[model samples]
Target: MSPENNPSSGIVSQLESWAKRNINPLFSKDTWITLGEYIGLGRPVSNRPITTARELGSFVSSRSSHVAQSALYGYLKTRAGTRFPELFENPKMLASINLAKWHIYIACISDLAAYMGVLLHLRTGSDNDKVVRLMSRVVDDIVDEIGMPDEAGDDFHESVEALKIRIENMDFSMHEDGDAVFSVSPDALYKWSPIADELKRFDRTPVKNSVRFRWKDVRETARNLFDAQAVIESFGEPGSSGSA
Candidate 1:
C-alpha cells in the first residue's frame, strides 16, 4: 500500500501536516514576545529577526537540539507502556537511553544542516561554493553554541560533511515546490543513524527499535520546524528588511 493509505504512515503524515501549519505561528515576533515575557527575558525592544546565515545557524542550534530531544522523549513515553514496558521498570537502562538521546540529537543536527544547506541554496540563489561555506559557518556556530563535547563534536562534523556531499549531488530542480517538498532519501536516513553502535553495545532491543523506528519521523519533523523558521528568516514580513 502507498504511504498515505498505510495506517502508521497516515498518522505520521497527519502529525507532520499539523506541525508545519503550527510552526509558522511559533516564529512570529508576537510569539517570541509572549515567550520572553513568560520566561522573564522581558519584551524585546526591537525585533531581532534571523537574517544572515550565521543568525539562522545560531537559531537552529538553539532550537533543533531541544526539539529532537523532545521528540524522542515523546516517542518513548508513548511506547513505554506498550512496546517497551521495561522502560519504566528498568532504571538501570537510563544511561543507555541518555546515550541514545545524544546520538539522535547529533544525527538530527546533521540532517537539519543538510536541509538548511538546500534552503540556503534555493532561497539565496547561491552557488554550491557559497552554500557549502555558509553551511560550514552555520555548523560551526551550532557546535560552538551548543558546547558539544570534543568526541561528539567531531562525529557531528563528519556526519554533516557526508550529508552535504549527498545534497550537493542531488537534482535540486526537484525542490521547485519549495523546502516542504525536500526530503532526505531512505538510504541517507539509514546511513545517518547514529545508534548502531549503541544498539550493539546495550542489548536493549526495545530501545534500539525505538531509536530506529522513530528516527525518520523525528528528522522530518525537525526539517519542517526549521523550514518554517527559514521561511520567515529568508523573507520576513512584506515590507521588512529581510524580505526578498
Candidate 2:
C-alpha cells in the first residue's frame, strides 16, 4: 500500500499534526527564556538582557529531559497508586529516584526517537542513506544541546542499531495503529532493562513487571517531548530569537 493510505503512516501524520499544534509552543525560545528568567538564570548582569544559547540549551535540557519520567511518575501515582504509594507521598524520595535515573530516561527518549525514525523510514520508503543521515543529524543536534556523558554517544548508536534490527523483524502490516508497534513488551531498544532494574530495587517482582508493562505510556510521552524538540529546532538555531 502507498504510504498515504497506510494506517501506520496515517498515525504518524496525525501525531506530527498534533505535536505541531499542541507541543511545539511549549519549547519555543520565548518559553525557554521566560523559564530561565523565572528561575534566575537570566539577566544576571546589566550587559546580558537575553539568555545565551548555552544557558537556554541548559535550561531546556534540565526541564525537557524529565518529561518522560514525569509522565511515568504521574501514571504510577494515579493508576498504580496501591503499588507505588511512595511516589505520591514522598516527594523527596521521588525526586531522588528520578535524579538517579535521569540518564536512563535520556537513553530511553533517544531510543524511542530512533525507533520512530525507523518507522517513518519504513512507511515512506525513503533512501536508506538519507534517512540514516537525517536521524544521525537529529540525534547529534540534540546531544549538542543536552550534553550527554562521555559514553552516551556510543551507547545511543548501539541502541539505535538494536532498534533497527527489531523493527526489521516486525510485521507492521499486521498492526492497525502505528502507535501499537511501540506498545510491545520488553522495549526493543534495550534501555528499559536499567529502568526495570531500578524499580525492582524497591518493589516486588510483580509490581516491577506491572510498571514495565506500562512502558508504552512512557514511550508516548517521550515521543511527544521529542516531537516538541524537533519542532522547536526546525524553526531556527537553538538559542536564537528566530526560533521563537
Candidate 3:
C-alpha cells in the first residue's frame, strides 16, 4: 500500500527499511542471530548462542528514541487537540530528557518512549498523569529487562517515587468549565460549547493551538540500534520489539 494509504505509516517503517539496506551484513539477517549479538542469549550463558529476552529487554521494550518519543507524544497531543483544540493548540511543553542508555534502549519495545517529550511539556493534569504512569510502566519493564545500576538504582527508585507523588497530588480541578464554557488554568483558560466558540478558537485551523512533534529526532537518537536490520529478517517474531 502507498504510504498515504497505510494506517500504520510511521517512522518505525522508515527506520526498518533503512536498516535493512544500509547496515553491514556480518550479522546476517535473523532475529535470534541479531538479538543474540546484542545480548548473547541462552546456550550456556558462557557458550550460549542466544541472549534471553530479559538481557536485552531494556533496550528492546522502550520508545525508539528521545526524538521519536517526543514525536509520538506530539502526535498524541494532536489527537487530543481534535477534542480540546484550545488547550493543545500551541502547546507549550517542557520536553522529557532521558538519563540512561536504558531509556533509549527501551524505545525498542514500547511506543511510550516516543511520547516522553510530550509528557515533559504537555500539561492536562489528570490526563497527563495517566500518560506519565503509562510511560513509567514502560520504564519499569525496561528496568526489569536490564536491571538497574547498583547504587544509582536507589536514586532511580526515589525519582520514580517522586513522580508518583506528582501524579497523585495533581489537581484535576485545576481546570474549570461550564456547560457553555471551558477554561484551562495556570497560564490560560477559556470555555466554549457552541460552533461559534470553536470557530473563534481556530482562526485558521492552526497547528499552533494543536501540538505537532517530529520523529526525526527519534531516528537520530537511536542511530546505534537504527542499524539493526535483523528485525526485517524475522518480520513478526513474537519477541522482536519496535517503536511506533
Candidate 4:
C-alpha cells in the first residue's frame, strides 16, 4: 500500500508535517536519520544484529559516541538558527533552549500513541502522577540515549524536578477555557495542544508527502512495531516496563 494509505505511515506523516510547519521547517531526511542514530534507532557500524524487539531495545539503550552526540547538537542548533550551548552545559535551562527536540519527542510520542494510550488506560492508580513520571522518563531517556555526561545526571534530575514543581503550581482556572496551562510561553502553549491531540489519536488519517524513509530498514521496523504493539495491547495482558 502507498504510505499515504497506510495507517502507521499516516500518523508519522502528520507528526512530520506538524514539526515542519510549527517547530522546524528544516527537519529533513538527514535530520530524521540523524535523530534515529542519535536515539540508537539505527544499527551501529559494528555489524551487530538487531533481530528482535528485545535486541533492538537493548541496542538502543547502549551509549552512543561523542561524534554522534555532537552531530545531533549541531542539527538542533542549525534548526533553531542559533547555538544554545546550555543544552549540553546546563539541564536547568532546557526549555529555555527552545530547540526542536521537545517537538520531536512530542511527535514521536504521537506516533506511539496507539500503544501508549492503551497502556495508559490500563494503569490502575492516578494517571496524572504517571504522566509526570512519563514526562520525566522522556527527558531521562533522551538524556541517557544521547550519552550525556554521567556526572550531569543529578543536574538533569534537578531540572526535571523543577519542571514538575512548576506543573504542580500551575493555575488552570486562569484561562477562560479552564485548560491547564504550563509555565512556558504562549507560543509553546499553542504548539503543544495539536501535538497532544495527535498523540490522543490511536488511529489517525493519512497525509500525502514526498519525503522517503531512508534510515536503513530499522526505520521501517520501528514504525511497524507500533502496530504490533497495539495488537499486543489488545490481549489485555499485563504491561511490562521499557523505554521508547
* TM-scores of the models, in the order given: 0.47, 0.37, 0.24, 0.25
Tens-place lDDT digits, model 2, residues 1-244:
9977654454444434544665433233333333232223222212221122222233233433443344345334444443443232355544444443444445444444445455435555555554454444445445655454443434544544453454334433343324444332223223333235555445444433443455555444433433433332343433444332
Candidate 4 lDDT tens digits, 1-244: 9766654454445545645655533454444433333333333433354333333323333311222233234444443442232233344444333333333232232222212222333432224444334433433444455443343333444443444354344332233211112112222223322223444243122110100111123233433333333322232212545423
How much lDDT does each candidate structure score? 0.46, 0.41, 0.32, 0.33
Model 4 lowest lDDT segment of ten:
206-215
On a 0 to 1 TM-score scale, where does candidate 3 land against the true structure? 0.24
Cand. 1 Cα-lDDT: 0.46
lDDT of 3 by residue, 1-244 (tens): 9877743343334434544565443232333233232222222212221122222223324333332333333433344442321221222311111232233223222332333313222332335454444444445555564555452333445444443344334433342221111111100111211123455355323322321122333333433333223322222223444231
Give the runs in model 4 whose Cα sits over 4 Å from its true position: 1-75, 79-87, 90-92, 95-104, 115-219, 223-234, 237-244
Cα-based RMSD of the predictions, in order?
Answer: 14.4, 16.6, 19.3, 15.2
Best of the two (1, 2) by TM-score? 1
The candidate that achieves the highest lDDT relative to the unseen native structure = 1
In angstroms, the error of model 2 at 82 is 9.7
TM-score winner? 1
Enumerate clash totals for all models, in the order shown.
0, 0, 30, 0
- Per-residue error for 200 in candidate 2, Å, reads 2.7
